[model samples]
Target: MGNAYYKLNKIAESIYYYEKALLLAPNDQEIKTNLSYAQNMTWTL
Candidate 1:
């Protein structure tokens, strides 16, 4: 879900969904990586 948004160049939405997912599974490395990526992309934008 968040990955899809990120690929679509919707960083804000991607981060939103990723944060929501993280709340559910704080230990998920994949989600953490994706959230980090999305955040980095947002900063770069």
Candidate 2:
């Protein structure tokens, strides 16, 4: 899962999973939020 990858500090994997999840539930706020968080992490890196 995205959250699991995020917690493990695997940003790319997290983003990948989150994007896949978004495809299934495009309007999901939680997935959007998590994806945003993962993306922001990339920016910080």
Candidate 3:
């Protein structure tokens, strides 16, 4: 879901979905990394 949003260039939505996923799996490093990437994308944009 987050990836879909990212592909669509919806960074805020991507971040929203990633954060929700993180809440469900706080220990998941992959999700954390994805969320960080999305956040960085927002900053770069």
Candidate 4:
């Protein structure tokens, strides 16, 4: 779900979910992807 958001360029949504997910699993792959993608976009998502 969150990964899909990041993949589709919805950096904000991805970041939101990734942050929440981080509470449970900080090393999540999808979260990493979202963070990286957001970083690349320079949106701080």
Q: Which candidate ranks first by TM-score, i.e. highest?
A: 2
Between which residue pairs do clashes occur in model 3? none
Task: TM-score winner between 3 and 4, please give it.
Answer: 3
Give candidate 1 regions above 4 Å deviation. Answer: none
Candidate 1 TM-score, C-alpha based: 0.91
TM-score-better candidate, 1 vs 4: 1
Model 3 TM-score, 2 decimals: 0.93
**Backbone Cα, N, C clashes tallied per candidate:** 0, 0, 0, 0
Question: Which 10 successive residues of model 4 have the least lDDT summed?
Answer: 36-45
Q: Please, what is the whole-model Cα lDDT of each candidate in the order they appear?
A: 0.92, 0.96, 0.95, 0.73
List, residue by residue over 1-45, the lDDT tens digit for candidate 4: 567787887777877777787778887886777667676775543
Against the hidden reference, what TM-scores do the models get? 0.91, 0.94, 0.93, 0.58
Using lDDT as the measure, name the better of candidate 2 and candidate 3.
Answer: 2
Best by lDDT: 2
Clashing pairs in 1: none
State model 2's lDDT: 0.96
Tens digit of per-residue lDDT, candidate 2, span 1-45: 999999999999999999999999999999999999889999989
State the lDDT at 34 in candidate 2. Answer: 92
- Residues 1-45, candidate 1: write the lDDT tens digits: 898998899999999999999999999999999999888886678
Candidate 2 TM-score, true structure as reference: 0.94
Q: How far in Å is the alpha carbon of 45 misplaced in model 3? A: 1.4
- Return the lDDT, model 1, position 11: 91
